[model samples]
Target chain A: MSPSSPSFAVEFDEINQEIVLRGTMRVRSPEEMTDATDLIRRSFGHGGHLVYVNIKRLTHLNMTAFRCIADVLTEACLADPQRRIVIVASSVIAWSAPLFETLASAQPNLSVEIYDSAFYPGQTFVEDESFIPILRTQTKMTWRHEREILPRHGMKEGMAIADICCGIGDFATLIKRQFNPTRLIALDHSKKSLEYARRVAAEFGLNSIEYTYGDASQMLLADNQFDFVTCRHSLQIFDRPDILLRELYRICKPGGRVYITNEKNSHCLGEPHSESIRWTYDEVAKLFSHFDMDVEMGPKSRRLLTDAGFDTIKVESFMVTNLDGDPRDFADVIEAWENVYAGQMAVRRGDSPDFIRRFRQGFKDHVLAALHPKGYAGWPIWAASGRKPF
Target chain B: MIERQVSPEPGAFEQMASLTLDTALFRSEFHLCDRVSEYLADIVAQSHEDPARYANFSSQLINEMIEFSFRSAVPTGQIDFRLLKNEERVRVSIEFAPVSDHQPDWLANDTSAIANGHPAVGDLWGLADAIRVNLHTEEHKENHVTLMADFALLEAVR
Candidate 1:
C-alpha cells in the first residue's frame, strides 16, 4: 500500500515548554515523522530545563510511530542531563501509559505522568459534595429560564442528546423528564459527581441516562453521535473553553444544535443593595479570571459559538429573579456562592481580610435583597446555541 | 478449538464474536485494528462492572493481537479473529496462514520462554505473559499460527 499520509499533528507551546501530540499515528516508516521530530528537537533547543510531552489526546500509535517518537525523546533526554522530559498521558487511552512507561524506564531523565484529573480550574471547588445542594438549587433556578429558552435553540423530543460536563446531572434529568430524548448520555470528569448523578437517577427511576466519567476535552465518545448537545454553566470555568467547545462541536451532528449557558457575574443585580452587589460580582469576575476562568463569558457566547464553526446561531439573555421561585431558595443560592467564592476561593487567593470582608458583605446584601419583602435579586445568564452546518 | 487448549478451561468461556477476513483487506487499512477492537470491546464491556475502564483495557489487548496479525499474516490469505470471555478472563485468538514452506521466527521461538518471563519492553510481543503461541501443521497441509492473549477481568483496586 502507498504510505499512509500523516495522521497526527505535533504542536509546541513555547510559553508552557510543552509539546502536544494529537490524533492517531500509524505510519509505514519512521521517516514519516521527520517533521514532528524536528519540531521537538527545535523546542528542546530553547534552553527550557523541563519539557512536557502531552499525548493525552493521542488515541492511537503504532509501533513504528512509537519507536520514532521515543527515539527523539530519548535523544533529548541524553543531550541535557539537567533537562527533564515528562510524558503526559491519560488513562482514558488504555495503551498510552503502558507503552510510554517502557520508554521512561530506559531514560532516567524521562517520566510518565497520567493526567486524568480535573479539566477545569474551579473543578475542585465545584465538585465537592458540599457544593451539590448549591448546584442543584442553581439548576433549579436556571431551569425555569432555560426550559422556556431551550426550544428556541432546537431542543426537541426523540433526538439523541449528550450533556457534556453534566456536573451533578440535574439538568440532564430535567431534560429527560421534559423532552424525553431517544438517547441521553451525561458525561462528567468527577467520579464523585457521576456517582451522585447515577444515584439520583436511580432514585428518580430514570434508568436511561448513561452517566459516564471522561475528560470533556478528549472524550472517547464517537464523532457526530449526538443530535443535540447541551453544555450548561460549564464553558466559563474551564481554563481552555475553546478546546471544550471544539469537543462539543465534534460530537454534535450536522444540522444539529449545540447549546451552552454562561454567567456574567458582573451583571448580577439586586435592587436593595444594587451598588454593593455589583461591586462584589465584579470582584467575583476578577477572582475567576485570576484562576484562568472567565465568569464574564456570558455575553461572548455568540462569538464563541460562531468561532467554533457553528452557524445559524441563536443567543438570548435571561434573569433568574427571586420571583422565579421561593425567595428563600434564591437566598440559599447566594449564601452558598458567598461561602465558596468569598469564603474559600478568596482566602485561597490570599486576599486581604478587609477585601474578603467587603466581598462577604456584598453576598450578604444580595441575600438580604432576596429575602426583602419587595426587593428583587437577579442572576443573569446568557444562553446561546448554533447548528452544525450539513 | 485452539483457544480451548490455550485457555485455562475448555468449557468455562463463552464466545463473544468470531470473524474471518482476507488478510490483505485487514492489513490494507491500519485503522481496522482500532475499529474492530473498539467495536468488540464495547460489546463485551456492557456487562462489565466498570464498562468504560473495561472497554479501554480490552481494546488495548485486542488491538495487540490484531496488530500482530496485521504485521505477520501472509499478504493474501484468510485470518480468523475470535473473542471469548469468562468471569475471570477475556481471551482474543487470531489464526492466520503463514508462508506455506516454513514457520515464522516468532512462532518458532519457544512460547514457554516468553510465558515464563516478564513481558520485556520493546520485545516483538510487548505483552508476553498474556500471550500463548501455538502452531499447527500436518502432512500435505499448510502451516498456520494461532496467537492468543488473555486479559484478566479484575476489579480495579484504585
Candidate 2:
C-alpha cells in the first residue's frame, strides 16, 4: 500500500532484515488496527527482526493504537527465539514516544531508535548492531545490582514472589531472571506498562509470571499468596503507607519475607524540601508508623518491623558506584534533585518562570558540587526486610 | 412588602394565575399547587370593595404567573409542560424526559419512586394552596378559581 493509503501497509525489507509498516494504522471506531497488523505480520512470518513503524503521515493516535503495535511486535519476537526486534521512529516529537519507550524497556529483545533531524538527517532506522552495545551496558548494570542485592537478602530459586509497583516490569524481570522464582506476579497501575511487561516476558520465553493492573493498596490477590513481597521505590507514594504495610503483612505467608528499598533524602522516599513537602512527608510518616511496627534507623535503611507481628527485622545499607565513573551520572542525580526543587518553588510562586529557572540552576550547581568525589556527597539508599512469624 | 392596586374585570383564569405567582414568590415552605390555591382564595376574599378592578388585575397576574412557571419548569431545555382543564379545575402538569447520550443510570428507577413519595405530593399541594389564596385575596375577590398540578416522567418508545 502507498503512504497515502488510509489502511495500513506492511512490507519486508530483505536487505536491511527489517519489516517496514507505513500509513495510518488507525481504523474506524470499534475496529482495532493492531488486529489487522497482527494478521499481516503473521502472514509474513518474519521472526526476530527489526520492525520500523513510519508514522510521518500519521496525524492522530491514541493508547489503543500503541498497544496494538506493541502486541504485534511482541508476538513476532516470541515466534522467533534467536532474533530481536528494533523500532525506529522519526523522533520523540510524538506523544507516543513515552509509550514506545515504555514498551521497549518491558520487552527484553525490543530496542527503539528515535531519529532526530538534527541528530541524523537521513538515517531513520534503528540497526541491530547499534542497539547491542547500549543494551549490553544497561543489562550489565541492572544485572549487577540485582545480583549484589539478591544474595544479601537470601533470595533463592523456586520462591513465590509478589513484585509491587512493577513499573514496566524492569525490576520484576531482573528479579525473576536472577532469582529464578517459581512464580512472579508483576503488578502495576498502568495498563500500557503491563502490556509492555507481557511483551517482554513473551520475548524472553519467561512464562512463569503473571501481570496484573490495579492499585497496589487494593491488590486483589488472596491472603498469604506470596512467600515474599518486594517493593522498589514505591512505598512513599501511598496515601497510607501503614495500610499498605498491613496489606503486605496480610498477603504474605507466615515466615514469609517483605523487602522495601528507597534512597534517603530522595524525592522517591518522601523527603521534604519545603513546607509543602514537609506536610506531605508528615502525613506519609504518620501512615507508616500507624501500623504499630517497630522502627530502627540504620546507616542506609530506616527499618520498620514488629516483634509482635513479624519474627525478625533486618536493615542493610549498600552503595551503587557508577562503574564508568562518568560525571554524567552525578549530573543526572543533581538534575533530578533540581527538578524536584524547581517544581516545589514553582508551586510556591504560582509557576513563575523567573523563579523556577533561577532556583533550578542554583540547586543543580549546589547538588553537583556536593556529589563530587571530595565533595562528601554520596547517594544513600536503604533496603530493609522483615519475616512474618509462622 | 409592597402594595399595588388590583385591576378590574378579573376572571377565574386571572384569579388562579395571580394566586400561583404570589404563592411561588412568598411562601418559604408549602406544597406547590396548594400555595397557588391559597393565594387565589385570599385575593378573592379581599376584593369585595372593587370587584371589577381586582378581577382585571387578577387576570393579568395569572397570565404572568403561567408564563413565568412555564419558562422556569422547561428552562430552555426539552422539558415539556401542558395546562389541562378537566371538569371544574385547571391542572398544570410538567414532564421531564431524559434526552442526553449519558443518562444517569438510576434516573429511570429512582424518578418513579421519587414521584410516588410525599415530596412530590407536597409540591403539588403547595401549588394548589397558592391558587386558593389568590382567589380569596382582596385583589381577586370577584373571581372563582380551582387549581391542581401533577408531575410525571415520559419515556420515548423506539
Q: Which pairs of residues collide in candidate 1?
A: none
How do the residues A1-390 of candidate 2 rate in per-residue lDDT, one tens digit apiece? 011123445666655565655433433222557455765476437433444544332322322344466667777667764556666654212333433565666678777675432211111111112322333333344345556776667577889999876766767777787788887877765545666677877899876676765345544344676888887655644434565676577678788888776544322221113333333333323323333221222232333456326556777665443333554554455454444334542443365676455555544444444455544233445677788888
> Going through the candidates in order, what is chain B's TM-score?
0.67, 0.23
Task: Name the best candidate (by TM-score).
Answer: 1
Best by lDDT: 1
- Runs of candidate 1 with Cα error greater than 4 angstroms are A1-7, A116-118, B1-7, B49-53, B100-102, B108-124, B127-141, B151-158
**Candidate 1 residue-wise lDDT at A56:** 87
lDDT of 2 at A179: 82
The TM-score between candidate 1 and the true structure equals 0.87
Off by over 4 Å in 2: A1-143, A266-303, A322-330, A333-337, A340-359, A366-377, B1-158
- DockQ each: 0.24, 0.00
Q: What is residue A260's positional error in candidate 1, in angstroms? A: 0.7
Q: Please write out the lDDT profile of model 2 over residues B67-149, one tens digit for every residue.
A: 22332232222322234332333334223322232122212222232255422222222222322322211111222112223
Please state the Cα-based DockQ of model 2 relative to the true two-chain complex.
0.00
- Against the hidden reference, what TM-scores do the models get? 0.87, 0.39
What would the per-residue lDDT of candidate 1 be over residues A211-266, giving only the tens digit for each residue?
87777876767678789999988899999999999889888888999999999999
